[model samples]
Target: MQNLDILTEDHYVLSAHIFEPRQNNRRILLINSATGVKQQIYFSFAQFFAEKGFTVITYDYRGIGLSKPNKMRGFPASMRIWGTKDYKALTSYIKTNFPGYHKFCLGHSVGALILGMNKDSEMFDEFIFVGTQNAFVGNLKLRTKIEAYLGFGIVQPLSTKLLGYFPASWFGLGESLPSGSAFDWRTLILNKKSTNKLLEKSDDFSRNLTQKVFVIRAEDDLWLTEKGVLSLLHNTYPDLKPTYRLIKTSESEKNEIGHINFFRSYNKKLWKIIFTRLEEGSHNVED
Candidate 1:
């Protein structure tokens, strides 16, 4: 494992880690984290792939985890910047140092939504969408929709306004986020265009991607739904070819695979679904 600092084109430094495979398989996997989630959350998952001879890497977006600044207030980081600058920097590094390798990117939640913001996304041979969706309120379940209205519609904006940042941890939303990041997140739920609204504000390459994408949805992920997942694929990434897999709790060792826990060490066995799919697309790894 190697830890290093990568500087974005805008001169901001991002914290990153790389896990080298024991036997070089010429395959690389980049795990992009969800909103307010740290890269450390993917360490075990990355190591699992590394052990299987896939060079795996992880990094935190700005204002989250190691890439965060000492002061949270007024930090200028939005999800758009995550893809355009932070993610692009990582791709630049991989393309330059690991040329000729088959690159695969696993996008968790917001990680998947940001793909449209960067052109580097085109280089990946395939993409893995985990616990991600369009997240428009209209696509959510009844319970989740009401929660979204009360939270993102009221609490999120008020809290972000008061603190100049969002103290997301108070609500079990992981680390605190920069004010801009918080607002951008609200756009996903409250805006009629959902992710497309954010994409319009920045560079959009969603339609350009036609690679096969393996989509995984945890049955117990309250924030995810078939409607939401299909919305993302049809509305935001219309050009991509997606194969869906719905994982039931019974498949997990602990009978739990929520929005983030599928990548948890306890559910390591579930990683095989991804491995099998990537190894041979025709292997019928669908769950």
Candidate 2:
């Protein structure tokens, strides 16, 4: 694994890591992490793909992990910037470095939502969505909906106001995030249009994507819901062909593949499901 810094068009430096394969299959994978989630969470997953002859790249978005500013307070970063600039920069780096390789992107949670902001999303041959959805409160379960209302509607805003950033880790959501990024997260849950509401600020390409998307959701992920997942497909990315798979908790050896645990090394066996879809997608499955 080699660490690198990629500069976005706005001149912001993003911390990234590339896992090189000993044997090349000419296939490349770019992993976009969930909101406030660190790139290190994907190291094992990236290494596994690398051993399988697929070069994998993982990076932290601005105001996240290694890419964060010296102080969380007043940091200037948001999800919109993540897609419009940071994600775009990564794709540009991949295109310039691995021109002939078959490219695939694996987006986790908010990682998938940002696709609409950047036209470079079209460059990938296929996409893999893990634990992602519109995440509107109306699309969630009653219990989760209440929590969403309380947390995002009240707690998040209050904390962000006091700290100049959202302490996401305090809620077990992930790491702390810039205030703008935190507000965008709140917008996703509170806004009826969900992802489309966020896209209004940028060039909308959510419907332009026509690639096959492997959509994977964990059954026990309390924050995820079927209604939200379907809404994301039909509303935000209607043009993309989707093959859905509901991963039962029993499928996990530890019986735990929550929103984040799906990528954990303990769940390595489940990774094959992704490999099969990218390696050879002959099945149009909705499990």
Candidate 3:
């Protein structure tokens, strides 16, 4: 694995790590991290794909992980910037540095949500979305809805307003989030129309995106309910018609592969399924 700095067109420097395969397979995989999550969490998965003959790259979004600004308290970072600017930079880097490699993206949660925002999304050959959802609180499960209400409706506003940013780490909700990102998430969950507005550009991109998309969701994911995922796909990619799979707990020893556990080393069987499916490249419905 090689660690390097990626300079974006907007001038923000992002920290990234690359895993090169022993033999080039003419394919490259870019793993995008979920909201508030660092790229290092996907290291094992990057190495796994690398071992499978894929050149993989993982990087931290600005204001998060290694790419965080010197002054994080009032950093001007938002979800839109993450999708539009950060992802654009990463894709540009891939295209300029590794020409001729078939590009594939594996995104988790907000990572997948941002793909539609990329103007160059059509360049990718395939996409794998895990735990991606619309994030509307009402569409979530009862318990999750309650949690979302508290987090987005109450906690996020109060925290961001008081501290100039969201202290998510202090609340055990992953890393701290910038004020803009926290408010953006709050708006999406609190108002259904917010998601619609956010996805307008992505919807247009999806309508013309010919490449296949594979969506994977676990039954026990508290953060993303089945209804939420379906609504998200329908709204964002009404014309793309992506394939999907809902993994049952019985499929794994843990008996519950929630939002983030699917990539853990213990879930090797699940990984194998994903690898096989990617190799196949054909769409099949699986409920």
Candidate 4:
């Protein structure tokens, strides 16, 4: 069954959904998505985790989805705004409300970056990152890099400056991509180094984690490249080096799933490796 609740922090109402199994489990899994994506995006995975005997919690960011939008009139809404504040609030809420369960986190893309940025906490027992990119498209083709810089570096700054904030819908052909959220993609370039620095400040947070981390990647993904992988390795918690791999051809060719499609795709096989990683505890999954 599914339950709904509200968690208010930093003056924003975060809408949370809980998926419970028939019997209560001692473990609870928190699913965090990339910027602008809603908690609803993880309905299937939430249900799957619940069915596997984990109570699952999913919520929207402060300025996105059902939660309250950032009320500031003239400032762009970057992922940095919501990542540090909203995720910390959600983590605190879960640690307080579900103290009995062994908490775990599953972060997708930039969601992993946000988790890496959080202050010290024992709220999460383990962590999994899907499609996490460490650095901004460094391994991508020259044209792709150019487009990112031009789109984010030039256009984003100008748009946010002129409009106070980028609109929620702008970019691509018929794409309803959020303007301020995408602009924050530029922040990724800046924060990539900062994320690494965060680990140094809290030596124990990285060294004393309760469970090891697992990283899953898709080979066809244009986002996280070899350079990003290096960055992730550099910043990861001590004794918790991530195990990772590219998606296999069988799933990719059959489903034509790429990047975001891995989560959004309706193929059960896509999650088989993920489940296997969870079962093995310390195993690294890769293509």
Q: After aligning candidate 1 to the native by TM-score, how far in Å is the CA of 278 from where it should be?
A: 1.1
**Clash totals, every prediction:** 0, 0, 0, 2
Candidate 4 regions off by >4 Å?
A: 1-3, 68-78, 172-183, 190-211, 236-239, 282-287
Model 4 lDDT per residue over 231-287, tens place = 665555445556776685466536455556676647556776776766555222211
Candidate 3 per-residue lDDT, tens place, 122-154, comes to: 888788989888888878888878888888888
lDDT of each: 0.93, 0.93, 0.82, 0.63
- Could you estimate the TM-score for every candidate? 0.97, 0.97, 0.93, 0.81
User: Using alpha carbons, what is the TM-score of model 3?
Assistant: 0.93
lDDT of candidate model 2 versus the reference:
0.93
Pairs that clash in candidate 2: none
Better of 2 and 4 by TM-score: 2
The Cα error of candidate 4 at residue 129, in Å, is 0.6
